[model samples]
Target: MVEKWLVALQVILAAIGVYQFTLSLFGIYRKKKHKEYEPKKTFAVLVAAHNEEAVIDALMENLKTVDYPKDMYDVFVICDNCTDNTADIVREHGWTACERHNPHQRGKGFAIEWMLKKLWEMPRQFDAVVMLDADNLVSPDFLREMNNDLCSGARVIQGYIDTKNPHDSWITAAYGVTYWYCNRLWQLSRTNLKMANFLGGTGMCFENQLLKDMGWGATSLVEDLEFTVRCVKNGVNPVFNYKARVYDEKPLTFKASARQRLRWMQGHFTVARRYFFPLLWQSLKERNLAKFDTALYTITVYTVLVTFLLTGYMWVDAALFNGPNFPTLYEYLPTWLAVVSVVATCAAFILALILEGVKSWRVYASLITFPIFLLSWWPITFYAFFTQNNKVWSHTEHTRVVRLDEVHGKQVS
Candidate 1:
């Protein structure tokens, strides 16, 4: 009887996997009809920085070359509780430095809220606001692409996030591989399907009115995800712009990377618990597919944990007790079907690399060992589950600095 129940659970989990698999297929059709538009929107480009003296200058220099009207857009650096000369660097670059000295409320989310309130009080009005990290390098066409999206009626947009230092180290390359894979398979696919795209911490843009409507009150560790769920519940879907690209600096060491991912998981678990039921209820009330999809995404973070626990129980029952041998999902399903799933996964990974224009051999080799990185998340999810309420922010130090031209290996016009 226990074995039968276990088999049923596995079948249900496998069905969800199939749903995701079908969604990934849509990613392959990457072509979208993007309309060319004049730059009529004014932008307030906001960069959140904390003790980022090493890389802030490079980002400022990169922003100077953005292919948009200079008077139409302004850059503001939120120097959040910085002991270093982060604010000084921004002022040196002739951008506004909004120095936030609140040690109690110290996170990217808080800093952004503070800055947004200040921007609202100021005389200058903006059509949209773009959020970025201090270590990110934007493509020259980023603002132009964002302008196009705004002109075409997209209120919230997430730009493509690429790695700035993929070949810097094995750890960095693995991080690059994960982002590259997710950017295409997840973000692009959801865009093609007309599903909501979540706001990545950086490379996110929001219409000023939308931000004011939502109040920008997501002060969690993963404020981006929290705000995304809020947007979905309010019937606003965030769209993705593949042409608007921002290169972020990845952590160079495994220790740094683990700390970063652990914080992300902790925040993810928090958002799931807080909004999962509300989103489900909203979806049912409205009979909206987009809301249903967003609800599934909010709760799907735990599917891995549930799957791991079930598999472990099956193994222990088979080994210790006089029970049926641990039955694989494949045992209940067809052998050919399992083989096809494996083949499809490999093809998807290879397809991501090819479509993302990943030229670094080191990044490719590091991705070959990417399973170890995925496995590492199992322990993180377990730890984060227990400590979801611990909202203490863990800052991942970014020292790797690369210019916009260096990332593409050519002069970026």
Candidate 2:
């Protein structure tokens, strides 16, 4: 009975993995419609920070260098629960600053909510709002690309994210690979299918009215995912803008990223509990594929959890008690089947890297260690089970202040 159950469970997990992978490949069929955009829409660029004095000036300077009229867009910084001079620097740079010191209410979500209310009360109105991380650097044409998409009837938009510190460590390089895979595999495919795109934590733009209508009070540790679930329910999906690039600082150490990943996993599960069944039920009733896809995406972490558990069980059961006398993975699943799974995964990574124009030896070399990075998610996900109610988060520190070209090893300009 144990052997039969293990085989059946493995089959189910295999099918789920294959389904998700195949679905991600829909980007290969995506058709792009391009147009020249007049940068007419005024923007309110928002930066959320806790203790980012080291990097705020660079972000502010980068914003000033954006290839758009200086008067057309205004920058706003929310210094939420900061002990450093993060707000003072924003003021020094002549940007709008909202300094919130409420010890009880923390996290980016609360900070954004407070700032939004304050902004709406002011006389000046922004056509759209773009949320950026305090540690991020933007492309010169980032706003222009967003304006084009906004004018073309996209109310929500997310930009492409590249690591500003990819070469700093193997961990950051692995993050680059993971994001490269995500950029095409997830966002592009969803756009091609006319489905909802997940709101990236940073580098996302939204029409002010859409945000107001949704009552944007997403306070989860993973506010982006929470906002995404709410947005999909209200029929507002983010559109992908590949040219609108945002350079984010990936965690260089495993400890920093592990905490971040666990928080993300916890938030994902929270959102899934709140939205998945409703989405699944709605899809069944209204026959909405978009909702179904979003639900499918949400539950994948759970599937991953099951896969890990079952793999461990099978390994132990085979080595200790099974009659097949230490059966190899190929004994449970056919050799050809295992080979196909690995080949498909490799093919996806190759396509993503090639499409993203990555030729770095560092990035290629890190691929050998990327599986270890992926494996770490298992433990992180396990910890996520106990952290569903975490309200506060530790901020990932960033101190890299070099020009984009320096970190990227090529002249970006």
Per-candidate TM equals: 0.95, 0.94
Across 235-321, the per-residue lDDT of candidate 1 in tens digits comes to: 899999998999999888888888898898888888888998989988998888788878888766698778778766767877899
lDDT of each: 0.87, 0.83
**Model 1 residue 294 distance off true place after TM-score fit, in angstroms:** 1.2
Instruction: Return the clash pairs for model 1, or none.
Output: none
Candidate 2: the clashing residue pairs are: none
Q: Report the C-alpha lDDT of model 2 over 1-413, residue by residue, as the tens digit.
A: 66566667666677778777877888765455689678889999999998999989989888989999999999999988889999999999899878899988878888999989988897899999999999999999999999999999999899988778887888988888888889888888888878888888999999988887877779888898888877777777778887789999899899988988888888888887888999888877878878777887778778767777866766777788863443334675567978888888888987888777787877887789889998998878877877767766667888877565565562121
What lDDT score goes with residue 157 in model 1? 95
Model 1 global lDDT (CA atoms, 0 to 1): 0.87
